[model samples]
Target: MGGEWFEVLRPPYLPVEIRWERAVADGLPADVSHAFGIFDTTLCGVQEAGMSPSDHWWLPERESACDACREAAGVIDDRRPRAMRGEDARVSVARRL
Candidate 1:
């Protein structure tokens, strides 16, 4: 809340959105599910509920967002092509001497 609302620009996303000075200034939920649910809503609510004042939403200051931030907020990586099941996309091996 100490930072300027305008200073923090909305991330580029398909559905343009804006965020306030979001700060996780409290103890977090003991599990992931609850945390995820809290963030499933808006930044304001999240902040009020002790989450970050800055959070992701479908609309930023009532404007549609660019595709990039939108997808990322929704945990979607569009730039990366779809992968097949059991695809060996990487190779890594470590041996200790």
Candidate 2:
């Protein structure tokens, strides 16, 4: 959970989600090699040169939170479990009852 996702502030205080690996590989500082790291694109494919990483979480309720990034990260408000989808939904419900 900790390394799965990270957030960064884009222009106008837009908070976007980024994958941990991509961030580290692309320029997120993890050690000496990434000391001068700088991330460019977000999970939602928004590219902005020289984006810095933030230690904050992606609060979806925030006014500046990026919706596209939220959707790309599968951070939606859907209450249904991942297993409860399509034909499996009926089967799951029957088992629960």
Candidate 2: tens digits of C-alpha lDDT, residues 13-93: 112233222322344333311111235666556554566445545444445555565565554324445544343233212
Residue ranges of candidate 1 with Cα displaced over 4 Å: 1-23, 26-70, 74-76, 84-87, 91-97
Clash count (model 1, backbone only): 20
**Can you tell me which runs of candidate 2 are displaced by over 4 Å?**
1-39, 75-97
Best candidate (score: TM-score)? 2
Q: How displaced is residue 54 in candidate 2, in Å?
A: 1.1
Deviation from native of the Cα of residue 66 in model 2, angstroms: 1.1
> What local lDDT does model 1 show for residue 61?
30
Q: What is the lDDT of residue 26 in candidate 1?
A: 46
How many steric overlaps are in each model, in order? 20, 1
Kindly list the per-residue Cα lDDT of model 1 for residues 13-86, writing each as its tens digit: 33222322223344533221111224533322332354543353334233333333344444533443344112
Each candidate structure's TM-score, on Cα atoms with residue i matched to residue i, is 0.18, 0.35
Q: How accurate locally, in lDDT, is each candidate?
A: 0.33, 0.39
